[model samples]
Target: MKTKKPTQSAKQAAVRYLSRRDHAEQELQQKLLARGFEQEEVDEAVALCQDYNWLDDARFAERLLNNGIAKGWGLLRIRQEMAHKGIHEEVVSHLFEDDEFDWFEHAREIAQRKYGDSPMDTDKEKARRLRFMQSKGFDFEQVKYALDVDDDEY
Candidate 1:
């Protein structure tokens, strides 16, 4: 297909999108294309946004990571959300490279917020809590840590 040449209007649209929130380049490209922009126009618009530091996937990823952590989301859920928003794996990976994040403590906090810190009285209750954490996208170890379930208990 013959793509139309780049245009200023596409860049304007890109800026409008960026003014609302930082966007991954791929996400901005797809939005512009969906709005009837040609591929070349979308590419130019994306590049223009990048040139102005308006659209940056790494920034988007970092904000997403921080937001997810604030919302008590596990790494799995955060990663999935970043991917869905067209964030690159490299960007996502870099955000997770920080070892200071205590995912276990975060999971435990989420658990306490949702289920309280009451000690489990039954094996069934422990399993149910474990399943709930898993549903929230926490890994097995983190979930166990949140519920304080020992390996021998399962």
Candidate 2:
């Protein structure tokens, strides 16, 4: 028997997902598959979506980066979100590139915006702020720079 083509509903679901926001190919496929669509159908729908320029991982990844930065999220946090969404490392690297961006400066701005010129007077408060910065995904060095935490400060 001849192979069956992907159904219209699969294509419709793919478009509907894309209509809301950009989705990575793998993410879209997972969504469709989770919706009870067959693997073959999801595969074809994803391929069609790519062909129609409706699904673009690079665009999605870039949007994530821009949005994360706008929200004062650190590079690590943004990259983790992208990876969770199934975006490839190559796609992420394409947008991030090298050390052209000053992560420490960005982290510093976020820290200053929240803590201002007044330093946390207690070790407890300082630890809390450091934990918050870590949750925001900045590395130790960046967090230290952001908080201006010299050894004597502790």
Question: Each candidate's TM vs. the true structure?
Answer: 0.89, 0.89
**Candidate 1: where are CA atoms >4 Å away?**
1-8
In model 2, the Cα lDDT at residue 107 comes to 98
lDDT tens digits, residue span 93-151, model 1? 87778758888999999999998868789878888888888877799999989888789
**Candidate models: Cα lDDT each:** 0.85, 0.88
How does model 1 fare in lDDT? 0.85
The TM-score that candidate 2 achieves is 0.89
Candidate 2 local accuracy as lDDT? Answer: 0.88
